[model samples]
Target: MPRFHLVSDPDDPVVAPFRAIKERDLVGREGLFIAEGETVLRAFTRDAPQRVVSLLIDPKRREKLADVFAGLPEFTPIYLAEQGVLDAIAGFHLHRGILAVGRKPPAVAARDLLASLPARAMVLVLCGIANHDNMGGIYRNAAAFGADAIVLDADCCDPLYRKAIRVSVGAVLSVPTARLSRDESIADLLDATGFEGLALSPSADEILATLKPAARTAVLLGTEGPGLSPDVMARARRIGIPMANSFDSLNVATTSGIVLHHLRFLGG
Candidate 1:
C-alpha cells in the first residue's frame, strides 16, 4: 500500500498544487491534467500508474477505494483530507471527493496513428468539435462501439479536459487518441492512410443504413452547426441519418453514437 499523508490545512505546502482549482482549470497546467472523481482515478492508477503524479482524496474514500490505492507505487504521494478541506482546495463543492494530477501521454501524429491501425478497424474523426461535453460523449460512444482509434483536428477541444474525462466516465483515458497538426487536412490523412471516409452531413445523398462499410472505415464528423467542410465531404462518400419531416439534425455527440453504433453493430 502507498503511504498516506493527512492534510487538514488546505494551504499546506505539499498540497499547494491543488489549490484554487476552478479558476485555473481552463488555463494550461503544463503537461499535467486534473482527473476528478473515483472512476477516473481508477483508470489513472490502473492503466497508467506512472503518469499519476499525486492524489488527494477525502478520508471517506480511503477505505472504499483501498484496492485502487494499494495498487499505486510505493513512492506515489497520497494526501488525505476531510470533506471541507477538499472543497476548500478545489474552490468548489467536490461531491465525489477525488482528484489526481495526471501526466498526459506523449502526442502521436495523425499519420502515425492512422497508419498503425489494423486492416479491419473503425475510427472516429473529429473536425472543429470545440465543446468539452461533446468531446466526452463522443469518446464514451467510441468506446462503447469499439472504435479502434480517434483522430481530432487541431480545432477540437482537449479530450483530457477534466469535465470531458468525467463526462466520458474515464473513456478518454483508455481510448487511443491522435491529433492532427494545424495545417493538416483531415482528408489528406484519411486518403494517405487508406481509410474509406464516411462524412456525416445532413445534406448527404447516401443513406447511412444502405452502405456496406469498408474494412477500414473512418466516420468523420464536424461541429454541430456547420458540419463537415465541403472539401472534407468530397474526400469521402457523404452519408446522412434520415430525419423526420421537420427535424433536420442531432447533437454532434449524439450523432456519433448513432453513426458509430450503426457502423459497429447495425447495417452500415
Candidate 2:
C-alpha cells in the first residue's frame, strides 16, 4: 500500500506538486496535471492508474476514498492532510477535499481512432472550438449522445485543459478525442471512411430534424463568434437546428448536444 502523507502547511515541500497545477510553466516542468474532486480523481485513476503520481485527501475523507485507492498499485502514494493545510497548499480550497496528480498521456490519433470505431459510429468534428468549457461541455454531450469519437481541427482548444476536464466532470477520459488539423485532410479522411461531413451552422438551409442520420456521420462544428470556415463548410452538407427566433443561436456546446441527440439516437 502506498503510504499517505499528512501535510499541514502551505510551505511544505510535499505541496509543490499541488501548487504547480495552476501554473502552466510549472506543470510543464513537472509534467503533471492536477485532477480535483473524488469523482474525477477516481475516474482518472480507474481509467489509468500508472500515470497517477500522488493523491491528496482531507483526513476526514480518507476512509471514503480508501476503497477506490485500495485497488490501485502499492506504489501509488495517497496523502491525507488537514483541510486548512490542503486549502493553503492548493492555493485555493478544494471543496471536494481530494485531488490527484497525474501525468498527461498522449492524445489519440485521428486516423487510428477512426479505424477503430464501428461502421455506424457518430463522430463530432469541431472545426475551431477555442473555449475549454465549451470543449468539455461538448465532450459531455458526446458521451451522453453515444458518440464514438470526437475530432478537433487545428484551432480547437486543448481538451485536456484543467478547466475543460473539470467542466466535463472528467468525461473527456471516457470519450476518444483526436485532432485533424486540416480541413482538406479531414474531408479526405471522411470521404475515405464513408462518413458524411454534416456541417451544423445557423446559416444552413436544411433543418436537423428533417434529415436522416447517416450510418457514419461527422457533425462539423465551428467557433462561437465566427462559426466554421468557408472552406470547411463548403466540403460538408449544411444542416441547422430549427429555432423560433432568428437571433437565437445556441452556444456551440448546447447546439452540439441538441444536434447530437437528434442526429445520433433520434434519427435511427
> Could you tell me which residue pairs clash in candidate 1?
211-268
Model 2 residue runs over 4 Å out of place are 9-14, 25-31, 182-184
RMSD to the hidden true structure, all candidates: 1.4, 2.4
Writing each residue's lDDT as its tens digit, candidate 1 over 192-248 gives 999999987677788888768998899998987788788888878888788998898
lDDT of 2 by residue, 147-266 (tens): 898988888877777778788888777788788755447777787778889987777788888888788888888876788777668899898776785665788899888888887657
Displacement of residue 210 (Cα, Å) in model 1 is: 2.0
All models: lDDT? 0.87, 0.80
Among the numbered candidates, top TM-score falls to: 1
* Least accurate 10 contiguous residues by lDDT in model 1: 259-268
**Clashing pairs in model 2, backbone N/Cα/C closer than 3 A:** none
Runs off by more than 4 Å, candidate 1: none
Write down the TM-score of every candidate.
0.95, 0.89
Query: How high is the lDDT of residue 103 in model 2?
Result: 80
